[model samples]
Target: SSLIGYGRGDVRNTVGNIPMEWYQDYPHIGYDLDGKKIFKPIRNKDELDEFLDKMENPDYWRTVHDKTTASDIRLSDEQVDLVHRLQKGQFGDASFNEYEIHSCSSGPIVEKKKILIPFSVSKMVHAIKMGWIKPRKPKETTPQYYDLWAKEDPNAILGRHKMHVPAPKMRLPGHEESYNPPPEYLLTEEERLAWEQQDPEDRKLPFLPQKHSCLRAVPAFSRFIHERFERCLDLYLCPRQRKMRVNVNPEDLIPKLPKPKDLQPFPTTMSLVYRGHTSLVRSISASPTGQWLVSGSDDCTVRFWEVNTGRCLKTLEVGGAVKGVAWNPNPAVCLVAVCFESTVLLLNPALGDRLVVGATDQLITSYEPPEEDKEQAVTWALSEGPEHDKGHRLTLTHPKGVKQVVWHGKGDYLSSVMPDNTSNLQVLIHQVSKRRTQNPFRKNKGLVQCVSFHPLRPYFFVATQRCVRVYNLIKQELTKKLTANCKWISSMAIHPGGDNLICGSYDCRLAWFDLDLSTKPYKMLRHHKKALRGVAYHKHYPLFASGADDGSVIVCHGMVYNDLLQNPLIVPVKVLRGHQITHDLGVLDVTFHPTQPWVFSSGADATIRLFT
Candidate 1:
């Protein structure tokens, strides 16, 4: 039929053919020429009948396949015969079952069964794969029927078997009550009777003493025990029973000798030699001959004194506050170098002569360059001509002024260190020649507080805030640098032997270091109560002197080969008090005679004292 223009009510065109739309939804089923579901083609009716028979026998077919088809849609007799032949192996005479044929014809009915009844299909498939679902034997029953018969009286069968029994209770005769005793009566009746059976005197037990208490009563107890035990033994009963009397002697105690009498006290007397000033004295020095002593002071002048007589011989006015006085080593003539606030005046006390070198502008009448070129060229001048020299003569212009001026022992060189609170250290090194070869030694990072040249060497030592720099004049180089433990190293002195160096610091400690060793100091002399400002070594003896801001000059004696622990010697032997002369005071300088054991010390009290 030429079917065309079909509508929703077009039954005539789709009567015997499956619609294409329905076939699209159920593509696995066979479709008619029109592409619509006509019938689900079954290739194995026998396998389906066998599966339905098994399910119907268990009353599960109504729940599984009743919704798909009714028995009224029967197969033809030919189809039935074909199914029987397929089931009973009549078609090929091969040993194949209906389930196997169904499984081979259908793409995967087992997979469909797995999706529908997963648990049953999985168990059956496992049994079939393991050969457990084979045809039943002729005399054996199936496991399903056997299991159904076995569950008939499961509870009765379990009841007939004996069950496990708990263990019987064990009642110990006396332990039952013993495990929990009565609190009111802890001891048992037999125990009480046994305790009562003990002797009354023993029951009232002897009090055992503690170890310490027994020790305290040992002596008395020992005597009593000895007496009683001796009496009871009676081996040597009475004295009268023996023919001769026996004597028992006690141990003899040696007497202690009385301590020897202490050493008798020695009378001490100190001799004060020369003291001839009314105000504070700042510095002192002894002449190289040990005959003359020079002292400078705030009194603005220096006084020369005889060593033996303690008499003042000369008084020269060095304008400004005199801070330091150093004596030259010439005997017939006494040369004194005085450090004033703004000037350094070299004087010959015997000749009443003075050479004023460093002059501040405030102390000068006029600031004029020397008219004569030879006179104008004072420092580092190569020639005596004015045209060639360009350096100006160094004039000290410090307000606080020149603090110290030291003359070399040979009298050929003079050094002056001035503090101006600036980066440059005002050091003037003048060669005292006919034609002056003056060189300014001016490389100090801070204020140069103290300077000292080695006693017999050309090496000079300078003390600053932190370190001591040793400069070698021969090598023209700084040879060594030493870290001073004291922050402000105010004073330094070289030992007479030149092996040891002593430095005093603002920390009130005098430390002595061996020049040969730069490590820790050998010894520290802590006698000063305040900052020690002056230190001088004795030229002859092993003595040294220290002057401190506490207005005291201490003469320390015996710093020779002596150990502080075994033979302590470097202690103050004499302390010269300055408070009697001034209240707020300090000692500026101290010196010893080159030959004698005399000490000369000057302080802020404006007085110099000679001590022996």
Candidate 2:
């Protein structure tokens, strides 16, 4: 074997076996009497004797350490010593002085020195001297556990000091508790009475965790918990609320609209009840002359009645329920166009104006017109609707059912919507004289809510769920895509000036969009209590109205000035509430009178109201 472990077998690690005198005489990488390091070996007995002579004078010193032997601050030796002594100091009274931990909270609960830094004076002094922070004054000490434990001696070897701590907690008495203590010992008068009022059956066992009300909400615990824990949680996260602002004053670009206070209040009266339909009325229209009011119902009939009287005038059995009705504005010939199923019937109500068509059952059974007039009478119908109606009838095809219908300014063009299915067509426009139909959509978007044609220009608007698209009719290209930033478009009313449009949404928002003021709605009204069903802009007045399913109507003045720089006026005029809700349904439609401030509203309650 090599001499590395010759006959030793790990016993070489024993240090006690060596002579202490020889260990002392060795100069093994240590300092001399003058505090100078010496690492050289002793080669002879004389050198060993020299080392032993040096060792006779013991030398003790601490190492001057550095983080990396590089000083950015270039601290002096005295400063380094001061830092070291400051670290070792407990109370900033003396360097390297010992301090026994004392806690006023629970009679010196912690005997460890480092755990008492919160109550130390040196920590605050070091923060003031080195960190440039103002030292916090030490508070007078009060021992919380002095009553439970024996009084502590302030002059003892272990240092004593005060500490901030909560009041002593309530605990179950020791094993010596032989009887139930009075309520006064544990609870206040109010708590004692509340505890006494508790039913014996609902009382829980003692000593186990008890269910209590919220800490801050419970008045009994207000002394201990002054604020709710939610305040602290709110500091970390915010809460949600309505972001809309009401009663905001308009800018100087516009002024408030003035109205007469003595005029007939809205919801004038139930002057007449036009009720002849067996089912719900889906569409209602007043003639351009305001002489006759026409209505379509689910009972498969289109009825015309005198607007002044409740008497029914004419009822045409188109063999299906009526969905839409509109009167051509040409006074030379009053054309009553009706949409039943997918077909539009153009009936000349002028000749048969005297007697109601369905006044007697025989009128409906024998109301066949002459064969020569059938071609012009049944003007236009979708190829999909009423396939059994035999005759050479003028017809136009549509992709879906027509929900709403509107006439152009000259009564030459027509626009209608089909909200159900937009597979091939969303809006259809038909030219009566040319007998040609044009569909304005190329792709199926969301549920098409409504469509309106420009009064004079060659453009039309189609409103989908959240967006409204404007397209030029002649060029067959989109011109503008207006975003309402609302949920589910419900209705739209375009201004006669052709520069602004107002939209109502199911989110209870009334948004006004300006073509010149940007595609986004410039102003929004979000005060409706429920989903808005219909909206209308008066033809001659500056008034605009929005109706909701909550049976309330809000009228706002939305007249934008002629000047480009002036802001639009949008002051809420009034909230007319007189319609009665029926079977969870309210106002279904609202329309403004073309010539007057009067507005007509239809509700699910089977009543039509004329509000002037």
Best by lDDT: 2
The residue ranges of model 1 lying beyond 4 angstroms of the native Cα positions read 1-270, 273-276, 351-400, 423-425, 435-437, 440-442, 558-583
The TM-scores of all predictions, comma-separated, are: 0.48, 0.51
| Model 2: per-residue Cα lDDT over 1-612, one tens digit each | 111212333212222233333334344433334555444343454777757745773431222212111111234556456667779863434444355544567534454544676668777887778868965889999864423232445643222543233568996553323234443344556755666678766654332222334455423544344366556655655665435466655685465455635322333333455677776566677777677777777788777787767678777676577777777654443555677666666555542333332231122233344455435312444232343232113344354566777778777677767776626565677666555566666775778888887866988888989999998978988899999999899888888888989999988898899899899999888968888888888777787888788987777767678999997867676777667787766777777666767677666676666666
- For model 2, what is the error of residue 513's alpha carbon versus the real structure, in angstroms, after optimal superposition? 1.1
Best by TM-score: 2
> Backbone collision count in every prediction?
9, 2
Pairs in steric clash, model 2: 300-321, 313-356
Per-residue lDDT over 1-612 for candidate 1, one digit per residue giving the tens place of the 0 to 100 score: 223323465322233343434343342434335666445344455888878767666443322221121112334445555567878867633365644524455557767775778688789999989999897668866653122223335464323342333467894433223334345434467755665788768653222222223334444454788888768757566544535466745444533322212211111123454566756777777766676678777777677787778788877665577777777554433346667775555454543222322221112223333435344223322212432122112222333467787877676566777765564545656543332424446456677887877878888888887677788988888888777777688888887666677888888988877666664566777888888878888766777778888877777664555333443235445666643335655766777768766666676665666655
